[model samples]
Target: MTTSTPAPTEAGLDLVTRLNAYLEDVAATLGIRGESCSVDLTGPVAARMRLNWRLPGFPERDVDLMWHEEHGWSAAVATHSGDGHHVVVAYLGGRTVASQPRLVARFADSLRAGEHQDCWPGPPMLRTAGGPSALAKELAAWA
Candidate 1:
């Protein structure tokens, strides 16, 4: 007899749901206001959560929270650049999500304690930046 395995997307959906909730709380704690946050779990490679916010004078910005299957989670700020013609995605932070609940809790704790900022990055972004973020360093140290 042969058995079937569950789709990775099934897991992705559950994780995305929990992550969206976490992001909502994180935004509230940070005092970020505007449209509520939501995660798009339509694809396999990446799940994207987005929220809109505006400062008094500057234009509204879209904050994107992305989860990459292999690379884990990160945040990005999307907005029109100074040239006023181009939109840009400013990289923020990332961390692995091997243990969904554990990682989510860790992120919540860190954010609550001001230990991990949204500007932190995971390994891939660390390589791009030629260095690691504080959270990444901490994660590595413990590993």
Candidate 2:
């Protein structure tokens, strides 16, 4: 049987919705112009059988996105189980420059605490959405 989450009534969402709302606040900054609270609604599942199916893959749960006007998608914090699977959140303009380690550090707890942060196209790849998924050398695996 499929896992059941609370269905949102015409008036409001279930617990997950409320939590995402809270996470969004912690992840985003004032300088950023956009604030989006979204979910990768696949499952509250698992992600590693080491490459096997038996290894319950991580579920696709809710992730918070906090965009900085000066930066891009600076943070992406999750509320439940499958939390730190993502690396970069949202990409900005068309020039991925100035994404400092300090900035990414600020977004840490917000974007899955204990996860590593890496910007796609850290230099010239700044302004594009999903600037590039090419893993960074220094990355400890995009948490």
Best-performing candidate as measured by TM-score:
1
Query: What are the Cα lDDT values of the candidates?
Result: 0.40, 0.31
Question: Residue pairs in steric clash, candidate 1?
Answer: 93-120
Candidate 1 residues lying further than 4 Å off, grouped into runs, are 1-13, 33-35, 44-86, 97-143
lDDT of 1 by residue, 91-124 (tens): 2334443324345435544433445444344334
In model 1, which range of ten residues has the least summed lDDT?
126-135
Please, what are the lDDT tens digits per residue for candidate 2 over residues 26-114? Answer: 33432221132233223321111010111112234333333332243443324455544544343323333223434533544333433
Cα misplacement distance, residue 87 of candidate 1 (Å): 3.3
